[model samples]
Target: MAFQCQRDCYMKEFVTTVVSCCPAELKHEVNGKKETLKGFNVKLQDTILFPEGGGQPDDHGLIADVPVIRVTRQGPEAIHFVASPLAVGQEVQVKVNWERRFDHMQQHSGQHLLTALADTMFGFKTTSWDLGRQRSVIELDTPCMKPAQLQGLEEAVNEKIRAHVPVTVQLLSIDDPAVEKVRSRGLPEDHAGPIRIIDIEGIDANMCCGTHVSNLSHLQVIKLLGIEKGKKNKTNLIFLAGNRVLKYAEKSYSTERAMVSILKTGPDEHVEAVDKLQKSVKLLQKTNLSLLRDMAVLIAKNFENNPQKGNFFSLHKKEGDNEFMNIIANEINTEETLVFLTVGEDKGPGLFLLAGPSRSVAEMGPWVLKMLKGKGAGKNGRFQGKANSLAQRAEVEVFLQQHCKHQTSEEE
Candidate 1:
């Protein structure tokens, strides 16, 4: 779909429209399945579906019971992407998705109210805004925001929502005197069209191009979630409105309940419980490491008396730490003793360490690594690597024993 199409229709329809159409194939993925939608790009005399623009998403609905998946504005005309093709010059019933439309209206109008309130109550100007599906955001020109200030602004905005302030729209030429009175982010550099001003009773009047509810009451409610740090000094305020706020609250409550049950604590004690549990875990890990170190010292003393056993040592265990293995090596004569150790619980790619006289150390790692189909690094008679399979442990031990004996005989 090109943006520069010139066959534009300017008449904007509110409810239904007779439209001419042309067949267009759309290839896209749905739910991870690629499929082709046999549809037509229908150009109507007018359309109720608002085309995506100005940070707001496009409206979706059916055109004569066939789903209109997408709508885009090509120049002045509203292009409806319908499921099946319609004959050229055929008049079709176009129904707007009122539920989705109303939701957008609530969110967009709620944003204007919130933005205006922020500006008036705290002197923060709205830099930009986005209308999302679940929530909306407004970027405020401020370095930081106080929690108390946010609470105050939220309370003030809800008060206006309860006031049921009437929202009015006015279209004025750029040169009109009243245009000067409207609050706008700024006029676009290429803008030549008349300004569309949205007025919220006595609260505010700002120039905007998006759809909005006619009354503040229609917003149901406005919630300021929080602020996110934005570029340099700007703050982006997250918010939700109407049904979305209720939905978010419901999901949050459900998640909190799950967390409480899993933590085995009530909501009031969850934070304290988690902190205490973390401290206990740290203490237990420290104790376990001390035990492993004691075991390493005992094993190393046994090797000191019987250096022959340590000369060609190979130990493969279900769970061992590299630090524990290195501690054992530190107690042995690393210049003469060759040590091959491996550790794993129940899987491939297990941790391994090899150390001995330089010649033996270099030969041991490459042969054992090849047998296990793994990789490693070594220097100064110490090599650390990973084994791909536990089944190769026996083969690695036999190969090391034979090579060590051959190397010993050659030295004699």
Candidate 2:
């Protein structure tokens, strides 16, 4: 009822007197805390700020110097959520955030122009649309479009913008004959009022409630970014309108400059230079892998012939990884001997591995990980895990030695 009253009373005026001000019925969250924000749900006789509706975001601005954070339609009233309470029955100066409002106008209107031309020239009806902050998209019913067709569609839309066609609006009875000429998916089932229609000269006439620019010239330009496959065999067309086009261009140019500096190559040679560097890195990686395998073989042999020391065979490599430790574990797991190998230096924590008969491997796996403040799992006769604090590695070695001694005593 409030939304209906406001819409009916003010129609589409930009500024008006405040009808009333009261506390908002809802609460909101600010920052990380839940606090009751002082919301002034002020209703104006007529205002320019669009309430959030019809897929377009609400306009934000100030009402008599108080920040208007949000706007919503309740029944017939457009409720303005203000920073602080305002006095009822007072005149307020309402200023729309023109930059944002104009940007939406450009994008929304550009979408209409593109959709109309696509339907007319290509028979690709728009299924849905989204007006994003940085870009806009129109999902077409058709599955795809050729590059040449996309290029032509873009040219046609801009041609209309240059032609400066007038975009006019009319409020007509739903039963009016002119309504028959308007293209739409049809009105809401409960709809019972005059239908608003937007006409772009001879190009398009469609039913809509969203705001738009008065003329195509205001759009400045429309640039199609590209298209992608969408839901249910649809194609999504991505584009930017007005200031967003310039913003995107500036961002792209800045990124290219940064890339050129980092790569130390001219723009034309950047691709070739990157490709060569990537190939070289790949070859070097292969060489390193071969060397690591050789090192693992040599390390395993050294420990193999040292003769049994107690029931455990333990070795710690200052520079070792999961792969290297695994290779050593495979080489030295024999005679039921518990092979405990650790690779890493005092520089940081390292990989810790324990491989032996199934029973010992299972027992020491969890114990070593817990003692070293790490975690891992294993099965069969192999167990490998990481050590977060290798400062405790010597302690682990002592524990393993003691465990081996205990087993020998029991056997004897």
Candidate 3:
């Protein structure tokens, strides 16, 4: 009889304890299934892994040396999936990443603080919450709030954080008499089974399903991002907590440092420096326009001296936009002459403008616009079009000259 290896049999029985330890090692089997460790099983002995529920992300860390790849809620229990397999009934030390856990705790507690403050100060109740990686948002029942009112509420929450109030977590059954003391404006009495209530001594007491820190001091700092009007009768508040606040501060400092270097000013003068740069830009733009106008005057004088005899005089120059060409056309239009000015590259894109003191140019304006494949309207003997190329400008000029002559002949 050939001896057979029990690898397949052993693989089926692999298990890791879930809730017996503080940081339980979760054994998982990988066979090309769900990514990010989802759908994996856990052997929790009354697990405390906060599942992804109640607008809070599941706690993440290593379990029994293997990474607790993902924690998700299925029904009631928080299931933790791990990477490597473990022996059934094997005792392994568990380790939870306290930093990640603590950050979540701060955010969760900060939310409670804010919600409690909202209810007490402004008669508003938090309806929902979204805990993001960088920011946390709480949606309130009231849709609108003045900036001054939001500022006051933020100041009040920060004061509580500074006070270092203890946050006590109590687990109670639905029938427990103490459950009556747990008052939340949003939660219904018959909503669920056993409920967990978080109490901030003398400040707040509310029913919550998320994990929180032991005290308000753990939150360290709470920064309000803003409050915006949301869907009917709901106001959304964005905030930052714990290390997120520090991270924001670090990023802001980096931005200020870069701005200081670019603006060539000290930290104190950064605002003033930016203001000065804006004013300088405006003055430079005005000076440039004045110079363009002077150049247009010069070009018109030269055109007058070397007049192109005909009903239409055409000129094309390398210019920025229609502004310069329009200026030159207006200067020449003062005389009883019709001018078709097209300014830009002959091989590339350009602008077209026709200003003349004749009804022929005005009548032929629509035809020229169509020939150039550009858009504009003419009224009171002035027309303009955005030309695709300087070649199109020449085409338009020829079309205008022929049309004007034809119309003059017809009138005669």
Candidate 4:
């Protein structure tokens, strides 16, 4: 038996009696996070909310003033998932979200028309299709389509829309001979009663169980957006239909306006403006690197002039990076001198490097890493890695000074 939703796709509201209501929970795992939806699985004598199936999402609505989160099909029954329970024998009014339902109808019917024309005109069979939140996709059996072919296909779909072709639903018995003549992908295992076929006037007839508009004119227009490479050597054609096309246009215009204001350029010059800005940024970055290298040489020279004051030198620069520290170390002669360099906030996490005597560096590198909550390795008297905390930097400098002093005393 066809559910009331299938019987009248246009119906937005209906009065019905609740057959059963039981507690249920739906869980979804997303990015390792578990989200559980607590609700009641409600079975109604008949409903206006279409259950999810046939590549179409379920309709969200209200039953007895309670919000319906989802609807699913079980055999011939449509189960409504609601946040609140309803009395079994109570007569309640069910309301469907008409705006969402109508939008889906437009896109679903548009897919049927596009699929039929592609198969007939270009011999492209639709392997599958998806009705997304903002746009829909139809994956064809072919690997790709030429630009001209795509343009022609889109034009043909809109032409049929302009022709105002009527879309009708037909039900056929499982054993009917005429059923063999129509297109189908086999009935569901739990499918019962007559098979439902969506016939697009004289264009084509295919088995489907989703809600659709009564006429192609209801589609308003179909815009083929673009194509993406699909898995299994298929070509996925992306498209927007009905109000979605208008929504896309509005969003695009708004973005253009914002860019024009920011770039101080007309819509036509946005690409050139962005390209010039990117080039300017790259040049600035290159010049900054050269200046940093020159500054590193100067810093090492100043330290060499006063090497007798302290063999251990410590410096921290917020703007200096790991490469900058390496440049300074290379310029400084460190046969007897040990230098500790850090780049980042004075008391927060950053980077640290130690370069000096081979034995001292090797022994102190792991100690520095542990004290700063970091990890690093030393080779040829240079140890550096990321530090999670620089709060103990002053204490680390004092310890290094004592070690150098102890070494000097032993040498005497």
lDDT of 1: 0.78
Over the stretch 267-343, how does candidate 1's per-residue lDDT look in tens digits? 88988998999999999999988998888778777877873573677776675788888988888787888888888
If both were scored by lDDT, which would come out higher, candidate 2 or candidate 4? 4
Off by over 4 Å in 2: 1-42, 188-193, 305-322, 334-354, 367-376, 384-412
Candidate 4 per-residue lDDT, tens place, 1-412, comes to 6888778999988999999999999774568899898889999999889998888998989998899988999999998888888999999999999989998898899999999999998999998899998999999999989999999999999999999999999999989888898877778899999989899999989899999999999999999999999999999999999999999999999999999999999999999999999999999999998888889888998888873746778888887788899988887777788889998888898999999989989999999999889877889999999999999998898898899889889998
> Mind giving the per-residue lDDT tens digits that candidate 3 earns over 1-412?
0000001101111233544223344444568553332334565643444556557777666656677676765554556666565555666555556667677778888998998888899898888888887899999998687889889988898888788888886667767888777666454333455576788999887777667778888888889989877787788999998888999999999999999889888889998988898999999999988888889888877777775545556777785467888778776753456788776777576777777864755777777777666777876778887866555666666776776577557768
All candidates in order of TM-score, best leading: 4, 2, 1, 3
Each candidate structure's count of clashing pairs = 0, 12, 9, 0
Any idea what lDDT model 3 has?
0.71
Q: Is candidate 1 or candidate 2 better by TM-score?
A: 2
| TM-score of each model, paired residue for residue | 0.75, 0.80, 0.59, 0.88
Best of the two (1, 3) by TM-score:
1
- Model 3 weakest lDDT span, ten residues long: 1-10
- Model 4: lDDT of residue 372: 88
State the number of backbone clashes in model 4: 0
